[model samples]
Target chain A: MNKRELAKRVAEKCGQSQVVSTLVINTFISCILESLEAGEKITIQDFGTLSVKQQKKRERFNLATNKVETYLPYDYIKFTASKSVKIKQKEKSVKKE
Target chain B: MNKRELAKRVAEKCGQSQVVSTLVINTFISCILESLEAGEKITIQDFGTLSVKQQKKRERFNLATNKVETYLPYDYIKFTASKSVKIKQKEKSVKKE
Candidate 1:
């Protein structure tokens, strides 16, 4: 499911109009990404933690080239799901509420 | 920032009430988790791809125990960030809209 489809489902489940749901969903994404870009560690209840992690530069020797290649340092997003999510994964199916 | 703080920020940015924003945020999380539990891959544009992945079982020698250890397979959530998000990370500051 993409954002559009998820928005529809969210709208129906939350009793909100499609327009409202779509707007809020888009806004939420923008807001979260903005925070993430700012290097904030965001923790969503029952979902996960969103943060940026740095991968240090490393040098590796290539047997074929017989030279060391240095890789640049990098920053990337990391998400660690909440324990509940893991429990749910084990459930194999969502229990309807 | 946790969900409460995130909801407050989202509410301020989206011009929604704190109550409404909180409700919508909670609902959105629940909706996404429900789908994830059902084995659906969720793709949020400009954010990332959310999916479940499995780590297969393997045998490894335990140096301390001096024996072979059998590990069971494990399933976990995986998130891959979009290219735009990486670009945003480089921006260091969000462009005010």
Candidate 2:
């Protein structure tokens, strides 16, 4: 499923037009991106939280040179879904297969 | 930030009412959750994709008994932000401090 498909489903479930749903979806993404870029974490109840975490730099082997190399530290965004969501997914997968 | 803050920002940016924006945001999250629970991956351009990945079961030690124990397999959701989003986040963090 992509954005378009998700938009269609959202529109159907929310009883809204697809165009409006699509715009809302896009705007939601933009909003999330803006918040994350501003160093803010977004949390949704019964879903999960989106936040940026700093990854520590460490020495890694240079495959070509076989020498230790230092890599720059950076941030990574992580999402940990809620337990209820995971259980629902597990049940669905189990039923399908 | 939290959902309310995000909704405010989104409403301001999109020129939409907070109620509508909140509804849209909630719907968007629900749509994504549904897709993931259906074992389908949802991708948003310029943002990221939400997918469930299987985690292999393995044997682990029972702390109290200190004996080998079988662990159940499960699924985990992962979100990898796009390169552009990462760059923007890095810049924003750097400027703030």
Highest TM-score among the candidates is held by which one? Answer: 1
lDDT tens digits, residues A1-97, model 2? 8788878888888777888778877887887776777777888777889887877667999999999998766788888776666534745445333
Q: Per-residue alpha-carbon lDDT of model 2 for B20-89, expressed as tens digits?
A: 7788778888778777777787788778877888776779889999999976667788888776676346
DockQ for each candidate? Answer: 0.46, 0.58
Cα miss at A50, model 1 (Å)?
0.7
TM-score, chain A, candidate 2: 0.82
lDDT, candidate 2, at A7 = 84
Candidate 2 stretches greater than 4 Å from native: A90-97, B62-64, B87-97
Model 1, docking class: acceptable
- How much does each candidate deviate at the interface, measured as C-alpha RMSD after superposition? 2.8, 2.2
Model 2, CA-based lDDT:
0.76
**CAPRI-style grade of the A/B interface in model 2:** medium
Give the share of true interchain contacts found in each model.
0.53, 0.61
| lDDT tens digits, residue span A1-97, model 1 | 9999988888888888888778877888888888877778899978999988777778999999999998776788899988877634645533333
